[model samples]
Target: MAFSLGPRAASAGYRLAVFDRIGSTNAEALARARAGETGPIWLVAAEQTAGHGRRQRSWISPRGNLACSVLEVIDTSPAVAATLSFAAGLALEAALRTVSLEARMRSPGSENVTFHLKWPNDVLAGGGKLAGVLLEAETVAPDRLAVVVGTGANVAAAPEGMPYPAASLRDIGIDIGAEDLFGALTDAWAEFRIVWDKGRGFGEIRRLWLERAAGVGQHVSIRSDSSTISGLFDTIDKDGCLIVVTSDGRRVAVSAGDVYFGAAASVGAT
Candidate 1:
């Protein structure tokens, strides 16, 4: 079924385009914006042929996953615009919490049913990877910016043999479709977006994100192009970079890297 956003989106004049298959919704959003289709728009796909995540890693975009991108013209600088990933992560957490509430009502006393946001832009459900957020930006003009926020979430299905374990709402017993999840996600995005306000609300966004952050104080390894750092996952700095406390008590700030908790390799996190 096609994704149908509610009146909130309709009233705001937001545009949406659905694709049966695509290389990447993020790529499509960028392409469309460059073609004079600038908008507070969304592009969604049923499947992807070449989806990718942070650091050029492959993102498996199988059917039943939320492969979507949101694009908009913004008035913020590129540095501030990057914080949208945190807003996107918070939005996904809101959506999951809303649905998890309903699931709990039906199956009372559900244990370990919680959601978390990994540093940068990944969401976790019960400590398992559930969703990812990718941010891309381009200078539309001297004073204006166009940004693409790409997201992928498992709704009805999850992939296997991933670096970190994968999970879907269905695997956790919340049987829903990608379209439905997108509907909730779109609405939730609107809610969290007020806290974004063109990067003016980074402080609040960072605070709220830290509340849902996963591995904040856990033993972890951060992998980069040629090296790895083992330490305790500290808070994300004000500039949105990861701060890791090394085993010997040195604090190192990482602007970008893949984080792993213990033996599991973390994916969709940067």
Candidate 2:
């Protein structure tokens, strides 16, 4: 099925560019922004030959997977632009719930599936990574920040043997297509984008994100480029940083890092 924006997104004047295959939707969106395209546009690809998540970790989207990015140009600081990813997380999770529920109802007695947003930028299902969100921003113009919120989901298949466990909608017994999921995401994004209000409504977004967060109050270890910190998953602060309470009762707010929970925290620390 061809990809098209949902009714709400279309009404919101969000444009869409669908590709059968692309190198990266995020790359394409940023390129458009640099070319003076000020847009709230969605770039979607059936497959992504080359895609990377945070810190250049490869994220390959094969056929039947969802590879999409939403681009917005706004006058905002990079710090504020960073919080947009939390809104994106909320949007994606809402979309996943909508599509997954529809798929589940078709099959009688399908096992229940729950989704949660992992700290930083991942969507988890059954305690395994189901999808990931990445935010990339650049100063294309003097005062315009070009922010691209990119997401890739394993609709049909999940990679095996990764640092953490991975899962797919199919693996969870939900038969869904990338096109259907993309449509839902476009609509969901429209709603959350308003709630975000170009970072003005981040307080609401932060609260909503924490409501569906994956590892809050659990043992967690965050690994950054320089060092690894182990602590309890406290909560995300107003600015959206992950706050972890160390064993010594110090609350450390991590701006960026790879997070692992429970026993895997040790493995992630190493």
Candidate number achieving the greatest TM-score relative to the actual structure: 2
Q: Cα lDDT of all candidates, in order?
A: 0.83, 0.93
- The true-versus-predicted C-alpha distance at residue 97 of model 1, in Å, is 1.4
Candidate topping lDDT: 2
lDDT by residue (66-161, candidate 2, tens digit) is 999999999999999999999999999999999988886887788778899998989999668999999999998787899999999999999887
Model 2, global lDDT: 0.93
lDDT tens per residue, model 1, 1-270 = 788774666666778898999999999889887887778887889998788899888887888888998998888888888888899999888888877776677777764468888877888884578889999999888878889999999887788888677888888877667887787788888777778888878899999999998888888777888778778888888789888898689999987877787556333224
Quote each prediction's TM-score.
0.91, 0.98
Q: Which pairs of residues clash in candidate 1, taking residues 3 or more apart in a chain or in different chains?
A: none
